[model samples]
Target: MKVIVGLGNPGSEYAHTRHNIGFEVIDYLSEQESIRLTKNKFNALFGKGKIGDTDVLLVKPLTYMNASGEAVGPLLHFFKLDTADLLVIQDDMDLPIGKIRLRQKGSAGGHNGIKSVIQHVGTQEFARIKVGIGHPQHTREAVVRYVLQGFQGDDRAAIDAAIERSTSAVKAWLTQPFSQVMNMYNSNK
Candidate 1:
């Protein structure tokens, strides 16, 4: 089984914020595939269904972004799945808005959610798809405020497009190898 995790904080207040872009992709995938995220376990909301011929578990951690590993590590352990079976979708402030990048493995690169996942999972060798949110400023405070806020006007349109592309890449991952998916998606950048 393949486990797809989208990192985001819980609660309506964070619904469409830049930091919640991961959750947005999961939501889109769920709707398109008819996968109902009705199960709550390991502090996560998840659903299991078939994506093409692959068995997939779509997850949204309820422990919030900073502590995402609390849910992800346990879930993978309980299912006896390896990190190789995992795919994480998250937002990236380093890339321009609407861009998406896929990596087979890497460090968190300052993302608290990915850092948490790496900590609990005990490795940096897992697939991830990063949707760019664009940096607002160089200061830490400004970065925090920017990520937690919702996108506006043109930014919103760009984000919407990015989300669509992210979902498509995810579906492709279910059928093809991670490296192939990365090559297919990353070359567009």
Candidate 2:
């Protein structure tokens, strides 16, 4: 079974924050695919279904952002899943808003949540789909505030479009080869 894990803090206060973009996309996917991510398992909000013919499990770890690996590592072990069978979705501060990038493997780039997963799993060989949340300016405080804040006006529409693109990207990944998915989705400028 393939697992798609969306990383974010769990709470209503974080519902619309840029840092919760992963949660938002997962929520969107669940809604569009008619699956309910209500099952409480592996310390996560989860739903099981299919994308095309591929059986998939959608997971949003409830251990919060930084400690996300605690939930994912056990789930992977329980399911006897390889890193290749996992796709991590998270918000990226590097790229501009609304863009998405897919990578087969890489460093976390200072994302504490991804770092935690890498530490627990002892590998960086998993796949990832990063949705850009746009970078904040030079101010340190602004950077913190930017990620924790919700999108407004046009940014909301852009975010919605990105989520839709992510769903299509997942379908493509399941049906086509990883190289094709990478080629098609990596330069999502």
Candidate 3:
């Protein structure tokens, strides 16, 4: 079984924020599969279903962004799933807008959610897809505010495109190997 976790804060206030891109992707995937994320477990909102023969659990950690690791660790233990069977989707402020990057294993690059997951899992060997939200032109505080806020105009369109691409990429990842999925979707050129 594969567990696909999308990192973000919960609640309507954060619904359209750049930080909630992870949640947006997962929600799109759930809708495509006609699955409702009604199951609450391991400090997360999730649902179970098969995606192209791969048993999948779509998750949105209710532990919020920073402490996401706490929920992921226990859930993996309960399900007897290894790091290899996990995939995380999140927004990246460092990348240029509209770009997507997939990595098999790496550091969090200062993302608190990924940092927490690493701390709990005790490894960085999980697969991940990062949706670019672009960095702010001004100070760090501006970047924080921008991400926590919401996307609009062309930015919203980019986010929507990313979600559509992520749905395809994730479904491909479940059935095919990581390399294949990366080759097909992880492109900026």
Candidate 4:
């Protein structure tokens, strides 16, 4: 079984925020697969289903961004799965807006959500799809405010396109080997 965990803060107040792009991709995938994320487990809102014969569990950790491991760790134990079976989708501030990168293993790159997952899972060997949200144009302290804000004007379109592409990359990961998917998505497009 493959567990696709989207890292994001819960609640409507966080909806459409740059930090919630991970959740947005999960929503897009759930909609495409006709699955409802109504069940709660491991402190997350998730849906279990199959996409093209690949058993998948889509998760959105409710414990918020900084403490995502609280949900992911238990789920791994409950499912009797290894870190290799997990795929975390999250936002990256360093890349250009709308860009994405797939990796088989890596550090959190200062992302609290990914850091929490690494802490709980005890390994960085899992697959991941990182969607770029870009950084604020002004002061570096504005990072917090930037991630919490919703996309605006031209950014709205780019982010929307990235979410769709992320959904597609996840779908590919469900069946294709990680290395193949990585080679296909990790390069600049």
TM-score, per-candidate, Cα-based? 0.98, 0.95, 0.96, 0.96
Best by the TM-score measure: 1
Distance from true location, Cα of 181 in model 4, Å? 0.6
Clashes of 4: 0
Q: What tens digits encode model 4's per-residue C-alpha lDDT throughout 64-177?
A: 999999999999999999988899999999988889988889999899999999999999888889989998866767998999999888889999999988888888887889
- Of candidates 4 and 2, the better by TM-score: 4
Number of the top-ranking candidate, with lDDT as the measure: 1
Q: In candidate 2, what are the lDDT values of residues 14-43, reduced to their tens digit?
A: 998999988888888888887788789778
Whole-structure CA lDDT of model 4: 0.91
Residue pair clashes in candidate 1: none
Clashing residue pairs for model 3: none
lDDT against the true structure, each candidate: 0.96, 0.88, 0.90, 0.91
lDDT of 1: 0.96
> What's the candidate order when arranged by decreasing lDDT?
1, 4, 3, 2
lDDT of 3 at 137: 66
